[model samples]
Target: MSLFLALVLLLPSSLCHRTKAQWHTCDSGFSISATAMARNITHCRKLQTLGAELGINNYSTTPNSSTSIDVVFSALPPTPQGWIAWGVNPGRHPQMVGTRALIAFNQPSGMPVVNTYNVTADTRRGCKLEPSTIEVGVANKAANYSDETGRLTMAARLTLPPEYNVSKLNHVWQVGPRVVGTVPLAHAKTLHNFDSKETMDLESGVGHSQRHHDIGLREAHGILSVIGWGTLLPIGVIVSRYFRGSPIDTKNKWFYAHVGIQILAFSLGVAAWGIGLSLMERSGQYRAFMGHRIVGILIFCLATLQVMALWLKPKMLDKYRKYWNIYHHFVGYSLIVLIIVNIFKGYAILKPAPRWKWAYIGILIGLSCVALGLEISIWFVFLKPDDKKAQTNASDPSKTSNPN
Candidate 1:
């Protein structure tokens, strides 16, 4: 009987040891240290951004009891002087504004240190992110930087409040380029940095990133806006200004072309504007983008007025024709300027790839070159003949004499 009982006890210990060894290897192709291995992490997830990975152990919660769990976070810093951070936001709507972050950085003495910070609204408004005690209880917090692999690993035992739900926890992670003193400077304002927040199921290790939800819609909005306001509308203006008396204006084709292009541009612009409204409704960042939204609305109103004025245009012989022309030219040029400004604002808000911004800049440069060449050619066409006539009269005064 004593030998049989000892065999049963030894069997469970051997199985547990085998399980621990299996989990010590992360799916991200890195191995945790022996200390983190001892945490007995049962679940691990490779995060979607920043080449991050998370591991959790003892993820248990009970009613009216504070939940305690061991967590391990790992990521490679963008630079040796950079820092890495991981956190949870317990707010009803999870975002970076209220995250309880554990930020890890190398001290001036080359020691890895982990500190907790409570990210607040002020932090978003240019306030410095200073280390502070967070609402979530963090114990046994430790960090290590590996020079060989260029990765930072942080481990902490978190004591979440009873009200904090582990099933749908919102987690955020980031890596910044440089650290000043002990504070981590801001990360890059790229799409990847903006998309680091996600909702995770601690028990099953299932999670979905915010990037997957809205990236398609955002791309659609940006493309349409660029084609309509940034490209087509400007082309339409060019046709009206330069094509009117050019060789291509045969049969008044320039007028028809301008109208057609404007109509198409307006249609696309209105669609993009509607999409922008829908996106604003779905997002919680209204305050951050308030200026962009306001400018978009103004552009829509002015463009609509321009389109409607097409029908109210005065005849070329009418006494009011000059006044109408003034209004038309003023409003059209104003719309073009506003469109360009707001397109740049959208770029800032979207924070797309650098190549995208440079592409738009190249397009603007191309358009400006075209406009400048057309202006110089028009001046030569109109002024050169007058100069010739004046020279002929100066040489032979009879050409300027009145027959009467």
Candidate 2:
């Protein structure tokens, strides 16, 4: 169950989990330094034009530039009581104000594409924001900048972010607005041009590392199944013969090793599985890669059933008894075949036969299948037949027995 839980957490986290540091959050209303604000202007410059392409607004600011930029914050009309604000929200999480900043983008369709920030601020520019300070408002939020054009206004929104401080000479701006990142129909061409031509080489390099990790990890996962369900069980049974009824009840060394190895293999496979899943998400191959998850669930069920069967009735000697052997063989062999078949399914999804993936899977499958066929044929034709004839002759020698 612990292993299962670990696996469950790995999937979604691997797929969609974002780095919190990149999007640090506090209670409510945050601030960012003026220097960090300058970087957005440079990044956003290339992402201007019409229609939506792609955009990004990173909060992690760059330092050392002694420049200030213009900043404007929209605020609620001054109340009769004047501007008011509080840090700890009503029974909700408190926000770290004066340390976070707002970052807005122009993404074409809310996809994760590298673009520039449409909204920015800096100290040297001496930018001024409307209702600049964290204060009481209609939304009870701070520093909200939005693109007024689209039905779904924002391409990305960072809330309760960290780093809300802004310092410029005498003006130290402590403002936290709902960081709004937008992909306006206004900046489509520029974004597309940079995303298509300028970004191809850089992004390809990043994409390569992610894709390679996925393909390798996924392919290795199949090997885990072969080792656990296929090879381990038989090895355990063979070992058990030597210690059929020993002090340690060493019925099968192979079985012991099989179980232990399987548990460990599952652990290792889990690591690989997680890496593959994360890579898939980063590469945007999640749709085609969903089948891998289904296969994992099935493998979990098979492993669970086998474990439960043994735990529920740990009959050491009875395991080798005639009736028990029949049940054991049936269940054990079924699991092996199921795992093997699912491995083939994984190969189909991850590989393109005769291609990189196909060759790897082909080698494993071809060998396992041929071995299984030979083993079965040899058992039925030679081993089992001889045993059966010996039994028949022994029975004939006792002809005096009553038919009833």
The C-alpha stretches of model 1 lying farther than 4 A from their native spots are: 1-28, 31-42, 62-64, 76-82, 126-130, 148-150, 176-189, 243-256, 277-283, 286-302, 311-320, 323-327, 330-404
Candidate 2: tens digits of C-alpha lDDT, residues 114-216: 1222122332123332223232112211232223322111122223212322221111111121222422221111111211111111111111112223434
Measured by lDDT, the strongest candidate is 1
TM-score of each: 0.71, 0.36
lDDT of each: 0.80, 0.36
Q: Model 2 — which ten-residue stretch has the worst lDDT?
A: 199-208
146-221 in candidate 1: lDDT tens per residue? 8887888888999999767777788889998888877789887655676788777666677755454466567667
Local error of candidate 2 at 138, Å?
37
**For candidate 2, what is the TM-score?**
0.36
lDDT of 1 at 336: 88
